[model samples]
Target: MSLPEPRDPSGPYRISVVCLGNICRSPMAEKVLTGELDRAGLSGAVEVASSGTGGWHIGSGMDSRAAALLRAHGYPTDHAARRFDPAHLAEHDLILAMDHANLDDLRRLARERADIGDRLRLFRTFAPDAGPSPEVPDPYYGGEHGFTTVLDMVHAAAKGLTAELAARYGSAL
Candidate 1:
């Protein structure tokens, strides 16, 4: 079945954070964005989630390092890895990818479809500063510091995303 569209008319703003695998960046983005909107009193106004370009991590929990970093930062831990699908082009209004390869992969996956390329967006479009970056940088292989930096990036982008969506749809919904 297709993923449900977000319920908020203003929009649940269905967003799916995507990376090479769901264990690292995308999951962090999903959880971080969820928390950011909640703290901003914009919770449930957006349907936020995460996935991977590949299925390697499907059904796995967030990487232990990722989980620890999130807990360290006081974010939620509910996550399950899944692969990106073509139907996702319709499932989510926005898809934030972690890097150039994944963004290309996502678009390639939707090559037969129309409208999704526009929906597939860089994960950093919502960053609070530094203009924009090409990638969110995968943190699965490094130490806590890499994970921490990922946290910083996702957190920055989440706020910008929240504000932009709120502006278009009115955050009150």
Candidate 2:
């Protein structure tokens, strides 16, 4: 699917990545997408941020395993966990959820706001070869290999999304 138009035509396109908890998938996607956008020359044309559906981990750092994997891959892991505020619906061009559950939570929070609902989608949907299930699985309870697997998924999606952004903003970039 194509990306929604920027909420503010003259401003940088804002995107918010989300998951159950901000410590894992969402933050990883955020950093990977941010780096991809920078590499694609859309660094100043887009703004990326991340949050969680639940408030349990608010103000926490990235999960240790998640942080270590990102660091090993040369991606910055600095993050402050926060809950996704419904009010942010108007502040972003897109809201990407890491899995179906997070997407459902965002849609429920969006409620009657059709404009926001249109902007919400599964993050992995941007992956060029995303299979039948595009959801990025939660790696928190698994082994180190789970985190590595998640990074691979995030990297693929980030690259695809960045390509779309570059196409749309190439002239401006």
Candidate 3:
């Protein structure tokens, strides 16, 4: 289960965002990040997707609030919730967990894939001044404010992540 480095620099840089349920945080991150990359003119160079650590919401649509928030921000809201598969380690260049619990779950799923350490990271790790809290809080049970807050956090981190990707694969892109 060894997580390999970006297999081919000339190929698309794959990214997978994960959370407890694919409907909220993960889908928002996915759409926001994809929008950021497209705005950066790096959409062709990057492949962004998301999934949940659990299977409960598999095949469902993104949470309504989450979809609405993304729509308001001019981001796409077309995403089908899916559970993260172990095989994703071999497919994606990076796996971003929205919170510590999801991060831990991904790591546990990695099992003996010791080499995956470099590729497994918290989504907020890319945010500027993220402080000690590296989570993109779940907004499903909260009010509209919660969804907006998650959007802000996701937008900030998506910008950072896009910049990092552009720097790393600019020429190839």
For each candidate, give its TM-score against the true structure: 0.89, 0.97, 0.94
Question: Candidate 3 — what's its lDDT?
Answer: 0.87
Error of 2 at 84 (Å): 0.2
Candidate 2, 1-173: lDDT as tens digits: 77898889999999999999899999999999999988888889899999999999999999999999899888899999999999888899999999999999988888889777479999999898899999999999999999999999999999999998888788583
Give the Cα lDDT of each candidate.
0.81, 0.92, 0.87
Please identify which of the two predictions, 1 or 3, would achieve the higher lDDT against the true structure. 3
Tens digits of per-residue lDDT for model 1, 1-173: 12223434554668889899899999999998898778777776777878899998889999999998899889888888999887778878788898989999998888888655467778886775736465788987788899988888888888888777666656555
Q: Which prediction has more favorable TM-score, 1 or 2?
A: 2
Give candidate 1 regions above 4 Å deviation: 1-11, 171-173
* Per-residue error (Å), model 3, residue 36: 0.7
Query: Which residue segments of model 2 deviate by more than 4 Å?
Result: none
C-alpha RMSD by candidate, in order:
4.2, 1.0, 2.7
Q: Model 2, 88: alpha-carbon shift in Å?
A: 1.1
| Cα lDDT for residue 164, candidate 1 | 76
Winner by lDDT: 2
Candidate 3: which stretches are off by over 4 Å? 1-5
Pairs clashing in candidate 1? 8-11
